[model samples]
Target chain A: MNTAALHKNESTKPAPATVNQYTFTPRVDIRETENGYNLEVEMPGVDKDGIDVNLEDGVLTILGRVQPDNQDGFEKAYAEYEVGNYERQFQISEIIDEEQIEASVKNGILTLELPKHAAAKPKRIEVKVG
Target chain B: MYSLERHLFNQLSGLNSLINGLPGGTTFAAPEGRSRRDEFPRLNIWKNDNAVVLTAEVPGVDPADIDLNITSDKIGISGELPSRNRAEGEAYQRLERSSGKFQRQVDLPFRIDTEKVSAECRNGVLKVRLQRAEADKPRKIAVKAA
Candidate 1:
C-alpha cells in the first residue's frame, strides 16, 4: 500500500458523513453441478430480514443491508471499515429451473441452489447390439 | 514528573496533527493500485473514555477457524475461509469471494488491559473490545477547599 498517496488524498475530501451509506458489490462464487448450479454470496453483517432476493424476467437480483453497530454513546474516533449495502444481479438462461430455485442465508453467506430443467439434464443413451 | 512527560508527548502529537492536517495527509496508505476498502475483512475502530472497539466483516468463515491474539500495544486477527464449492462433478463458473488464509494486525496508541478484553462473533461480524490500561485512563483530581 502506498502511504504517501493516502496522505495526499486526506486533504482533498471533506469529512465523511456521521452515518455513511453506500453500496458495494458482494463477492460471489458460482459453481456448476451435475444436478444444477450453486451460488454463494458473501454478505457479512446482514441479517435475514435485511436481505431480499428476487428473480424476474430471467434476471436474479440480490440486495442486502447491514445495520450499524450498536454502541452506547461511543463516538467513532477512528474507522477503516464502512458499513454499506450489497447488490448484485445475474442473468439466468433457459437451462436453469428458476421455479425450483432454493435460497438460504447463514453466517452472512447466501446460498442459492438452482436445479436444472428436466429436459436440460444429461441422459446416457443405451445402444443394443444384435 | 508524569505531567511533564505527558506534556512532551502532547506536544509531539500536536505536531503530528499539524502535519496530518495537510490536504490528503490523513488518508490511510493503501496499496498502489488498490484502495484500503478493498482489503478483505475490513476493520472499523472506535474508542471511548474506557475502551476501544474493533470490528471486522468476515462472512462465510467458521468461528472455529478464527484466531485472535491481543497484547498491551497491539492486536492480531487471523483466520482461514474454506472454499464452499464442494459438489461431485462440479466446476466453478465465477468465483470472486476470497478463500484461504487472512490476517490483520493493528497497533494501539495506548496500552490496553488484556484481562478486560472480550470478543464476540455473530452474523459474520467479529467485535473486540479492549479496556484502557490503568495509566492510560482519564481521571479527575478532586479539588480540596483551601
Candidate 2:
C-alpha cells in the first residue's frame, strides 16, 4: 500500500499551558486498509473523559490526561514508568476525508479511522472482450 | 531473599527520585543489565504502614486473559494480548504497540496476606491492593511497670 497520504510528525513541542509534570509521547500503530487508515494509540490510565482529539490545518493532534494516583501517606516502594499526560501529532494529506474521521477509546487504546476521499479509492478496471 | 528484594526496591525508588529532581526534566537511562524491553509491563508500587498498592499499564489486554499469583513476598502477573484482526488488503504502516504474551514479577518489602489481595483492571491499567499479613505487621509493645 502506498503510504504517502499520512505520516507521523516526529518532533514534539511542549504544550503551551500545562502543570508541573512530564508529557509523554504515546506509542501508536497505524494500518492501511482498502477503505482508509486505522490508528491505534496507547494511553494507559487515561479515561474517555480525559482525551482530546483535534484536527486543524491538516494536522491531527491527540492529548490524554491521567489523574494522579492518591498517595497521601504512602511511600514509593518501586518505580519503573512515570505517570503523566500523553501527546502526539500526525500530518494528514488531502487524500483523506477530513470530515469523515472517526475516533473511539477503549481499554486505554484510542482507535481512529481515517476514511479516504471517494475519488482516492482504487477502482477495479474490468477488461471487455470484443 | 526477601531482604535482597527489599534492598533492590529501595535503590530503584532512590533512582526515581533522582530522575524527578534533575533539571530540564531529563529522563534517566534504565539500570544496568535490565533494559526496558525485558520488563514487559512496567510497575509502580506504593506502601503505607499496613498495605501496598501496585499498578501496571497493560493496554489492549482483556481482563480475563490476565493471570496473577501472590505469595508471601512476591506478586506475579502474566497475560496475553490478543492481536487485532485484519481483513484482506490491509497492511501495516507503522507498528509499535506490542502484543502476545507478557510476564512480570514484583517483590514486596513485607509479607502479604494472600487471602486479602484484590486486583482490578480499568482503562488498561491494572491495580493490585495487598494487605500486609497480620503476623507481619509491627505491633505496639506496652511496657509494664517493673
Q: Per-prediction TM-score, please?
A: 0.76, 0.81
Clashing pairs in 2: none
lDDT of 1 by residue, B1-146 (tens): 33443344345434211011111222332324335655666777788887888888888888778899899989889999885646666666555677788998888756899999888887788999989999888789999999
Consecutive 10-residue window with the lowest summed lDDT within model 1 chain A: A2-11
Model 2 lDDT per residue over A37-86, tens place = 88998888888888898988767788888767666778888876677777
What does candidate 1's lDDT look like per residue over A72-111, in tens digits?
7677765665566666666666677878999888878888
Displacement of residue A40 (Cα, Å) in model 1 is 0.8
Per-model DockQ against the true two-chain complex: 0.25, 0.28
Give the TM-score comparing model 2 with the true structure, all chains together.
0.81
**Against the true structure, whose DockQ is highest?**
2
> Candidate 2: misplaced stretches above 4 Å?
A1-12, B1-38
Candidate 1 residue-wise lDDT at A111? 88
Task: Please identify model 1 stretches exceeding 4 Å from their true place.
Answer: A1-20, A127-130, B1-34, B84-88, B142-146
Q: How many clashes would you count in candidate 2?
A: 0
